[model samples]
Target: MDIDVNDSTPPAPEEYPDVDGEPPAWAEDRTPLGDAIPWFRKFQGGMHTKEGILYGLLISGDAGVRSYIDDEIIITRTGGSSERDAEGKLSQVADQKDDTAISRSVNNSMKFNIAVGVVIGKKNKILKRKLPHAFNVMDYFRVAYVWHERIDGFIAVRFRLEKLELEEKSWWAEKGSPAPPRTARRKWVKPIEHICGACAQTYYRIYMQGWMCLNTSCSQFWKLPDGNDPPVELDYDPKWLDWRHDPSDEVQPHYSLVPDFMSVIDDSDPNSTYSRTSWKNGIVCPSCKQCLSRRFWDGWRCDESCGFKRVLNMQTISLRAVVDDYEVAPIRRAIVFDPGPKETALIEPEIDDVYSHPYRRLVFDLPGAGTVTHFVTNREINAKPNGPNDLFIQLQQANLGLRRYPLSQAGMPYGFVVAVDSLPFSEACDPILRVMGRLTWATHEATDKQGVTALIPNELLALGYFEDMAINYHDDGEDTLGPTIASLSLGAMAHKSLRMKYKYYNGFTKGSKKLVHDDPVLEGCANRDWRLDLKQKLDNNELDWPAYEAEWWRTYKANKSGAAREAPPCIKTQLHHGDLVVMHGDGVQKYYEHQVELEKGGGAKLRYALTARHVLPAKIEPGQWPKGQFQLTKDQDYKGT
Candidate 1:
């Protein structure tokens, strides 16, 4: 066994020892792959032995054989057909793009190397892969050294694997896995290229891999290729493989809806108004007013936006709504009117009004619109008509005709937008806009004191209900929506209930106190900020502090009671015909979910609701209303005749 040895090889560095030598402390435990490295080395050593040298595994002599995956490896192709000899046999070359793509893909997958080593074990059974073919390692070859003057000269190895037979009874076929077969009988094979033999015309393989001829009159399974068609070429590109491969053994990173830049603290400053479990008061940039924390940036400037910087020892303030307020309401069977600004104020409910009257109703007299009854009769004599009666009628008719929103598409509450057919400020909608503005001005309850007006109703939703129809529980907590939501019920009475979400329900339960831990735990050195390390850890998917903190609080709260419980306290209310219901703060939406059930005392009668909201400016659809028109149309008189 006199095998040639490269005696000129450089010594392995002491700083970086092999797995067998004194391993680094970081490699405390040997992984399966690490354990396999010695076996690979042993195999390489054996290949150099006299008996082992017969398999052309070394580059020392002319015995080393390198096979190209592609027939045209040295030359690039220009859309040439698969070349063949006069024997009409398929060429033994792969498409260059495909060959390169597969090579890159195989190299990138660490599993491929591990799988090769694993299958080379004592059993030597073929291993199954999600790719088009299962495979088994048949041979191993490694070059010990190259005649080059490089430090720490390395060894490179290659494995020769043979594709295994596809099992017809395997779960892969039963599950309809996308892995294509390698070969097919001639009778079942069909041309994958554009032209269809039956149609003698170009056709797409869009419907299926074995697509039938696309002549509607002649479309039949008989015209389709047999299941024995040549195997579809496997695309080994990472992007391509990602679509076809099943991620049966991958660790997905955890994701939090909280902004990447945001982190939660266990405690708050004595003077700070950041309420327990509330985003009420937080450090915010003076310019754009986005949340500012130690994790994302220095001081108060959001690096991505307006570079507004400010020094803050520890100050917390509320951010203002970025969009204007708006709303709409339907009157009982008679008519729906946008009770202009003055009238809206007269009909507006007080801050804690729902507390006193579980179903309180109000009546007010507008200077020009006359006396109006809330939660009772819908009234309007003859003031400035809200808009052309014809327009309102058209909107109602359209509402009836529009299809019910599908549950699958219900990202938000399933509802329909009012036919603002005119500009958001047109005569038909201007009165509604003014009404919304008045409601906004009337809402004095400041969830956070940095800004006064929290409820802005700029978007109007005309929601319809069929007999026995009920709205599933959900919260309007989208970043785009304002703190307050106002609803005007019409036609029939409906029972509305607000319930705390399961995660936060305990907070509202009897004697359940909020979990508080406001300590300066995230320590930083004088020279280096530990917060930066936290951010890096978060970005690298190493830590999820926000989710961890939230879960910690939940567990703490649950354990405090010393009893296992699931639900928390819930608040319920009812919206009668012509009733006005207003949600005062964003807290309710963030902490709870609400549902509306149709009260069925009056048989199957239609119930309509006019819901209003202030959507963030960026969320408002472009062209729904011209820019700068919200305020402009407020003071403008309706010219609709």
Candidate 2:
């Protein structure tokens, strides 16, 4: 079949604008209604508040709920949680109860003289028009009317909202069906006001048939004076629907449609005077004008695919300046050597006169786990050429292609960059390899009592942290990974802590609610009295090891309803510049997890962590192996001193 390739080829698909891949031309010049205002949770229902002030309201057109929307007016039903019976099945005929706090807040907005931003959900069938975005911002609105109404035998609170700027043209108006002229005023009619004899609550005669006490709390609620049943079919008074709101000059919102990003300190500024918290808020893209959350470690990027990205230029800071700024406190050694069964304190090793090394070696042993060795580097390594200071500068200048990675199932990227197997042992990575070699040697000496072989690292993970960035508690436990893991710290000082994993931390069972297990469990935590009592029983020979374990489980199951508590850190220490840390034994990874956080206060603006690990070759796919080999040159290798 000798057919011409050009003849057989299909013509290029008709090109319309790539709506998802590219921003429209008008996106840069015109501001989007949704982006101009602060919408914290755009997709959620109910009201949105900022700084304890109600600022926005989200209305969705749910079934059996009446929510009408036009150009200038919107009549919406209040949100309520679904009621369920004793059998856990949803109730059919019961009235949905509104959150008491939310109802009170919404009712009091008028009294507080607050104007709320209105955003309409696309599910609103009353809109009768498709919207360009998932949600359409209909400008600021003031609550014109609020009253309790009975719908389908259930009491529901209804709100009537009028556009604040009545003269302005509505953004949702279409050419085929234009919005009614704002200048045309509706005839105003005052509804007859009634005072309930039982509750003394003032209500309006909204229905043409009759008036009744609408207050749910009153004994005469929804009851007529004649003691007759109210009509199931009700008709609203035409006059009440035609009520008009007079323009008011009092209602003013605290936030503006377009937030002023230029007024604040520029994030790209070289000076380190500003706190990282200042730039943590959402940023408005200069190219697309769309607001984006701070998702990247280096800087901000337009998620709308506007091809706009701003990478922050970080400068290496002096360690002396950082120490001065932090008011360097004296390092504290572990006070409790042994935790004595009941306590969860880390057992610090005694620094006896053994092997005399240049750096101070501090080893912390974890019972039933492994050991954590901390090699506190001397002044020579901290200040020498091609040392921590130089290495920090080299990392800053090198293009390591570091970025935050999505390590969890949720797909949300981390706050800090985790560049794994990207930089080999060469040039910028030479110092890391040198430190890893020293750590391997130190690990062998430290774990001599345990008789564990020191594993030489074949893989490296370089992590970069900006101000306010941190790595949360997680284990590097993988089937392919060897027993030993080592890391070298550079630039800013950090606090590294290792803790034992709690059994009920993730969950007691599948789909069960996870227990709160954060550090510093002062109150609402499961008391340690049970453990102390059990330990006493064992010490008195009342129970053996197996019996003791069985009794512990029995007590744990019995007190399962008690608040969950996290185990305190077994080893807590500071990792200064040029410091090397190592963890030996697979049990360490299985039973414990570690976290690293940058020291607070106006300290160094940047930090780098290079961790080395050994990956079993047989576990990896043959085709997925990394290209090129890394070798530690003789000069680059470090042997103790």
Q: Which candidate achieves the best TM-score against the true structure?
A: 2
TM-score of 2: 0.70
User: How many backbone collisions does model 1 have?
Assistant: 9
The prediction achieving the highest lDDT against the true structure is 2
RMSD of 1: 27.7
Which segments of model 1 are wrong by more than 4 Å?
1-401, 406-451, 507-569, 618-641
Using all chains and alpha carbons, the TM-scores for the candidates as numbered come to 0.30, 0.70
For 1-641, candidate 1 gives per-residue lDDT tens digits of: 23233567443322221111111111111221121122221222112112212121111111111211210011011111234447543232322232243233323332332221111221111121121111111222211111110011211122232112221222212133344443342123222435656557664342233444444333332243762422322122222111211223341211111122224333244122122112211243434433333221112334564675543232222111100112122332232333235311213322322422322333322222122223322222111243222222333333122223321111122223222222243333443453344334323222222254554455555555544667878877777676666665654457775544544433223355443222111111111133334345555677576754465455545546444243322334445444455565555576556788876543333455656666656665565434213553444332211
Off by over 4 Å in 2: 1-47, 57-109, 118-138, 143-162, 172-175, 183-193, 204-216, 222-245, 262-268, 271-274, 303-305, 311-316, 320-356, 405-449, 504-507, 510-561
lDDT of each: 0.33, 0.59
lDDT of 1: 0.33
User: After aligning candidate 1 to the native by TM-score, how far in Å is the CA of 414 from where it should be?
Assistant: 13
Worst 10 residues of 2 by lDDT: 407-416
